[model samples]
Target: MNYLELDTPALLIDREIMEKNCKDMQDYADREDVALRPHTKTHKMSKLALFQENMGAKGITVAKVGEGEVMASKGLKDIFIANEIVGEIKLRRVRELAKDIDISFGLDSILQAKMVEVAFEGAEKKARVLIEIEVGEERSGVVTEERFTELLDFLKQCSNIELLGVFSHDGHSYGAKDQEECRIINLEAQRRTLQFAELARKKGFLISRISIGSTPSMIFNFPILKGITEIRPGTYIFMDASQANAYGNFTRNAATILSTVISIPTEQRVIIDVGAKGLTTQRRTKGFTATKGLGRIKDWSGVALENVFDEHGILNHQKFHDAVQVGDKIEIIPNHICPVVNLHETAYLISDGKVIEKIPVDCRGKLK
Candidate 1:
């Protein structure tokens, strides 16, 4: 069936473009001599994650423990939860998953490490973990060398916890003013991450993997530092309006929302069936990835979603209003693909305008 026949407010994936995206990222990783561990949090689909693995991904990265569980159930052996896992319930889930898979999670403090150590006590395998270093994203990570040293010292006494390496995300690269700025942020973040890894090794810890990534940085094809081992970029799989703005084009965008024109109330006002619920209200208001509007209308140059409500999208363009009528189907590229993907239950894979396959968002809403 063609995508046009599908219902309104549907998620669509262009298979050909998506495959090229996967291959190009893998090739980039190979050229840099680093393993590609693309994050599954972007798509939240087991089939797509396995597709990435088949395309030479060393492993997969997830944000939440429940997402890791879903990927594991789908036969993903090597998984990394690239966020701190707190609480006994989530830590216990990670411990259970570690029994059969090479699973690891993020840690930034001694308090969190102690919880992990206790959760993995008496288990067959030690709880593997990566120390998160703050790289100017202002997010969760060890901000000072003293804090990192203290955490490492406490972990040395834990019998059930094993320090695998250190990782950092230059998420601030997304807000870089230009390519040069993005490059500078990427290099500094990687350097900082490597510094942490070297410090761990110097302290007699076996630091193996040094991972760093951000789609804005990785997309530029910058040189990887000497000690970095892996890159974990999630949004590269489905470039959105914001990323396209950063790249200065939408050629790399592979995912879009298929929506229908529901009303033509005025000469300059057109309404679409999809709104914040389907396409999301996300907008990049600063730097290179800054987007002009809520979403961009695919194939409609200079046309954007002016506003959106819960069930309707507003497009105020004289040309757009005159060109499209009610019942006309149009595709919209979201501002941020990650959260937009989690809003849908399934995605239709399109090839030459036909629906080739339908896959479920297996890890959607797996926030725990």
Candidate 2:
């Protein structure tokens, strides 16, 4: 079946592109001598996760507990809940998952360790917890070696939680001015992550993984230190507009929102079926190139998605609008693909306009 026959506002994945992106990123990680734990949150499709595993990813990473459960149910042996899984219900679920697979998660506070300890005290199995060190993301994790050491000490007391290792996300490395700056930030992030690992080792901890990297930091930038064992990059598999603008160039941007020109409301403007709900509202920040709104018209590369209503996207370029008409299908390259994918049920896997398979977003809204 031809994927183009599908209705508007449908999510589509170029299978060839997705496979290439997976292989390329895994190759990079292998060449750098680091374990590749591709984050599954980007696509939320277990099929894609398995593809990553098939392409040489050491393990897979999910952002939520539900996603972790879904992957584990599908026989994914090594899974990491990269976010803190707090609360009795979530911790118990993580512990349950650990019984079958190698389960691990991020830890930034003693409160989290205490929660995990209490959750699995009677179960005889303990979950490995990676103490996240803040390397500039400021989103989650311990900021100082003292805080991480204290967290490790607390974990030692808890018979139900094992100290996995140290991990950090150099998200700030995305803001680097050039490739040189990006590389500097990458090395520095590894440097900071290694420092925390050394402290843990000195404290008699069986520190295993010295993991660090975000797609923006890891793709173009290389780390100098061999102490870093694993590289965790999510966005490299599906480059978006913002990642493209930040990470040198977004050559592997496999994912895009395919929309249709529904109406020519005016002579200088045409409306598309994809709006904020379909394409998401993410945009790029400062860069040498320009990016705006939810998406850009693929036919007209220079034309940006000028205006977005609740269910309509308006492209207001005179040269671009003249060629478009009612009932015409057009491709829209989304600014960000993650959330854009989450809003859909099944993304059609396509190759040369042929529908290969309809992959379910199995982890959609699995927030619990």
Candidate 3:
């Protein structure tokens, strides 16, 4: 089937570009001597996760227990929930998952550890975990050295849990003003994570995995840092407009929404079939890159997705008067691909205008 025949507002993945993105990251990890555990949240599909494994990813990382459960159900053995899974119901589910596969999650607080301990107490296998260390992201994880030591001590008392190592995300690197600042952020983030790992090892804990990654940081600073066991990068698999803006290259963006111009409402404005529903409202942040408006128009350079309704996307550009007309098709490189992917049921794999395969968004709506 031809890509144009697939209807409007369709999510398309370019086969060539997607394969290169996965292989390039894997090769970089191989050269750096670090494990590449590509985060599954971006694509949210078991086939893509399995494709990463086939390309030499050490494991796969998911943001929630539900995502992990979906991956595990597809026979993915090694999985990491890179977010804190708290509450009795969540922890009980985590324990049940651990019974079948090598399951672990991020830990930043003692309250979370206590809950995990209770969830797995007297079980045959303990819940494996990686203590999250704050590394300038300030989103989650233990920040101070005092909090780090205290959390380790608390985990020692938890008979139903086993500490795997440490993990950190230099998410702030994404907001870096330039490559120089991104390099600095990545270095500091890794340094702080390693310091916490060393402290845990000194405290008689077996520190095995020292993981750190954010696509912006990893792309700029791989093979520079040593002693890091794994790097978990999610967005690299499907480069988005924001990533291309920060990292400089839209050519690597494999995922895009194939939208068609439905109406030329005015000389300066055109409406596309996709809206905020298909192309998420996320935009490129200041200091990251200089992409104006909401999303980048793939075929039209100066054009942008100026605004969106639930069902209609507004494209306004002075050039729209001659560059596009009613019923003309255009592809939109989303400001963010992760959320945009979740909004779709299936993604059509395309190659040179031909539809190669249809892949389900298997983990779509797994928000538990």
Candidate 4:
């Protein structure tokens, strides 16, 4: 069936473009001699995760235990929960998963390490752990040398958990002023992660894997830094308007929100069917990216989504107001693909303007 025949406010994935994006990243990882463990949080589809695995990805990276469970249930054996898994409930869940699959999660505190140790007490397999280091992102992970050594001391005595390696994410690269700043941030992030790995080894922990990544940093600094074993980038799968703004264009954007121009409220504004509920309300600021508005209109470079309510998006620009009318359809590249994907239940796969298949977002709303 044709894509236009479908209802408005739909999520569409260009199959060709998405596959190309996957292959390109995988090839880059191969050339760099780093393991490609693409994060599944971007698509949240089991089949798409499998598609990445088939394209030479070492394993899959997920943010939550529920997402790891969802992927494991679909026969994904090697999984890494990049975010710190805290609390008894979540620790028990990860421990249970380790019984059948090769599983690992992030840790930054001695308390988390102790909890993991207690959770895996007397388990058949030891819990493989990665110590997360702070490399300018400042969101999570350990930054101070004292705190890292404290966590290392706690892990040294634990018999149930094995310190696998260290990992870091240069999330701040998204806020870089330009490509040069991105390069500096990526190198600094990698250097810090590698330095911490050496610190762990000096403290008697036999470190092996050293991972660090973010889409912007990965794109700008691949094969330049050494000693990093893996790269976990989620957004590269479905390039968004924000990524296009930082990188170049939407030619690599695989996903788009299909919406209709519902009303021409004024000569300067037009309303779209999708708003916060469908396309999300994430915006790009001065340092994040060069995106000028809420979202980018595909092919209509002169127009953009200036504002959005629960169910209505206000399209701005004179060309947009003049060219678009009520009932006209437009495809939008979202500012952030992650949250936009979470808002949809299913994504329609398209090729040559026709629907090829429909994939369910099986991991959607798996917050726990």
Candidate 5:
């Protein structure tokens, strides 16, 4: 069946475009001689993760242990949880997963390392972990050399932990004013990450992987610093409005929300079936990936979602309202595809306007 015939408020993935996106990123990684470990948090689909792996991705990257479990159940063996994992229960779950697969997670503090050591105590496999280096995203990870030294010194006493390597996320590159700024930020972040890896190696730890990524940085194809082993970009798999804006076009956008015109309340007002609940309320306010409104209409240039309620999207454009009539199906490219995908249960894979497959968001709400 045609995607247009599908129910309103549906998530649609252009199969051809998505496949191209996967190939493009993988090819870039191969050319750079770096491993591609695309983050699965963007699509949350095990099938897509497997597809990426089969297309030359060395491994898969996930944000949570639950997502790791879901992907492992679908046959992904090498998994890395890129976020810091604390708490006994969660660490125990990670421990259980490490037994069957090559599993690892992030660590930034000796306290979390203690939890990991205890959780994996007496287990056959030691807990493999990576240290997160803060590279100006300012969210997590060690920010200063002194604290990093402290954490490393403490890790020397841990008996059940194996230091995998160091990783960093140049997320702030999304807010870079231009390509030059993004390049600077990407290179600096990679340099800082590699510096930490060298520090760890100097301290007698075998830092095998020096991973770093952010979609904007990778999309710009900035020079990868030597010794950086892997790139873990998530949003490249399903380009959103923000990423499209960064690229100056929507041609690369593979995911869009398919909604139907529900009402034309006035000549200046048009309402669609999807709202914040379906399309999300995210907007990129700065940098190259910055978007103007909540979302962009696919075929309608200069028209955007003005406002959104729980179940309604308002378009305050006379031309758009006049062009589209009630019951007309429209596609919207969301500002941020990551959260928008988590709000959906399944996404329809479309090829040449035909619904080719239904991919489940298996890791949806796998926040634990």
Candidate 6:
């Protein structure tokens, strides 16, 4: 019944902390009039996705079709794939899901739209679509208004596709100089989505949703400006070391990797059981909150453990290393929680140090 008894290298979630985090974000979104559609890519658990929906989330945001398939099987009514969905097989799968749920995904160009149009030709329903605007994050999406307009026209002519709305991820905010930069990124993202939505409306295209979000930036999106309809932030549900460093320590980030001290190589060096396989080396952070190591030691705050091995983590903390031993258990607040979650099959939901429930990482490895 206790999470400690479960096993080593286990994914642990503090239920109370997770609940508080969700509710707090929901409340913030409600106050701002922005629909909270938390991203399910971080947890990769449909149960957690449903949990977000139950906590005032309008829907869940997924990054891949494989993830959408897993969630749809669990009866999730609405989902938006925030990333571009390509490939014929993947598109056909998307069409198949359109028959069951309110499915939509990101589009950057008409060529991608053409691929979808062909895939949905024989489908029983049309695909819901959203044009992802590149507000600041240089990942994907139409970066200019002209390009945005071009993509809209392309999708509008499609018989099998319906233009639902426009969305943007203010991911660039994470690298800002201060909270002001975060606000500017989100504000500009909202402005871009709204601008495109207005243009589409004027052009006689039906634009119903105007979405904008980022976990670090959404914390400042409370004053809901006009035209912003939805907020899809995934990290708010489970805070990580990077997020904690970005948003401050008050955030309710409840998930962490519970590892064991495998060896005390020396007084200044220690090895943890968790390695690249369990915790990834994704240091996709920005600004002063950027992390130099693979992850931070949760039990020992402020210790960013570096020198990650394939099967071991080399921590360079003299006092911290001296305090740990070969068999002592330690919790890691990973640099990036998303990948760490994908490596685990399940998370031990803990309350008061006891395992209350075991939830599968249902959407884990849904990279297709």
For every model shown, what is its TM-score relative to the native structure? Answer: 0.99, 0.95, 0.98, 0.98, 0.99, 0.96
lDDT of 4 by residue, 1-368 (tens): 99988898999999999999898888889888999999899999889999999999989999999999999999899999999999999999998999999999999998788888888898999989999999998899999889999888888799999999999999999899988888888888988999899999999988888988788877654454778899999999998988888887679999999999889877788888998999877877866476777888999874678899999998768877898788889899999999999999999999999999999999999889
Off by over 4 Å in 5: none
For candidate 2, the per-residue lDDT at 86 reads: 86
lDDT of 5 by residue, 33-62 (tens): 999999999999999999999999999999
lDDT for predicted candidate 4 compared with the true structure: 0.89
User: What tens-digit string does per-residue lDDT give for candidate 3 at 318-338?
Assistant: 876577777877888988789
- How much lDDT does candidate 2 score? 0.81
The lDDT of model 6 is: 0.84
TM-score-wise, the better of 1 and 6 is: 1
lDDT of 1 by residue, 200-297 (tens): 98899998999998899999899998999999999999889999998889999999999999999987899999988887888999999999789999
RMSD of 3: 1.1
Which 10 residues in a row give candidate 5 its minimum summed lDDT?
315-324
Angstrom error of the Cα, residue 214, model 4: value is 0.4
Query: lDDT scores for all predictions?
Result: 0.93, 0.81, 0.88, 0.89, 0.93, 0.84
Clashing pairs in 6: 239-253
* Cα displacement (Å) at residue 241, model 5: 0.9
Give the C-alpha miss distance for residue 289 in model 5, angstroms.
1.3
- For candidate 5, the lDDT comes to 0.93
Q: How well is each residue in 1-368 modelled by candidate 2, as lDDT tens digits? A: 88778888888778787788888788788787888998888899898898889889998999999999999888789998888788998988887888889989998999878887888888857778898888876788888777877887787788877887988888776567766777777778888889999999998999888888678776664654888888888877777777766654445677777788888877788888878888767776653223666676554656689878878888788988777678878877788777888888888888898988889999988878
Off by over 4 Å in 4: none
Q: In model 4, what is the error at residue 19, expressed in angstroms?
A: 1.1
